[model samples]
Target: MEEMPLKTAEELEAECLRLLHANMTTREIQRVGIVRTHADGSGPNWTYNQLYPEPTPIGKHDAHGIIASVAGKWALVA
Candidate 1:
């Protein structure tokens, strides 16, 4: 298997700041959510819906990875 590249905290912080300056809103950043599946396959699957409303269906972001780099630092915006 191929290994994933790692980034420094400072680098991540910088990227996040740049994204915010590029006109990304707090709500847009908040929409980035993670999904998890059960190992035993008996638990219910959960999802986050910001751009939509549905129990089993969740919303999506146009640029999720770019937004998530901020790591939920919505308070940083003015």
Candidate 2:
């Protein structure tokens, strides 16, 4: 019979965390019941989604802007 190699400490830690997360996801699913398993697009999220912020447009004056007159009229004079 052939013996398999043992995992290193780092590998063990990573594997343990992976298993824990899998178990938690499974438990959450079961607790929520089968009918509502996928109710949320996201599975019981532990983190909020602000990693990538919503794109904000820069003011035209800061970009490829035009000049405005004292009369509150804008023209392509810039």
Residues 5-65, candidate 1: write the lDDT tens digits: 4333344445544564465333234222333222222223222223222112121243444
lDDT at 41, model 2: 26
Q: How much is 22 displaced in model 1, in angstroms?
A: 0.1
Q: Give the Å error, residue 45, model 2.
A: 36
TM-score on alpha carbons, each prediction? 0.32, 0.27
lDDT of 2 at 4: 27
Best by TM-score: 1
Deviation (Å) of 33 in candidate 1: 16
The C-alpha RMSD in Å for every predicted model, in order, reads 11.4, 26.3
Candidate 2, residues 1-78: lDDT per residue as tens digits? 232233332343333333323542221111110111222222221111111122124422221111111111211111
RMSD of 2: 26.3
Reference-based TM-score, model 2: 0.27
> Roughly what TM-score does model 1 have, to 2 decimal places?
0.32
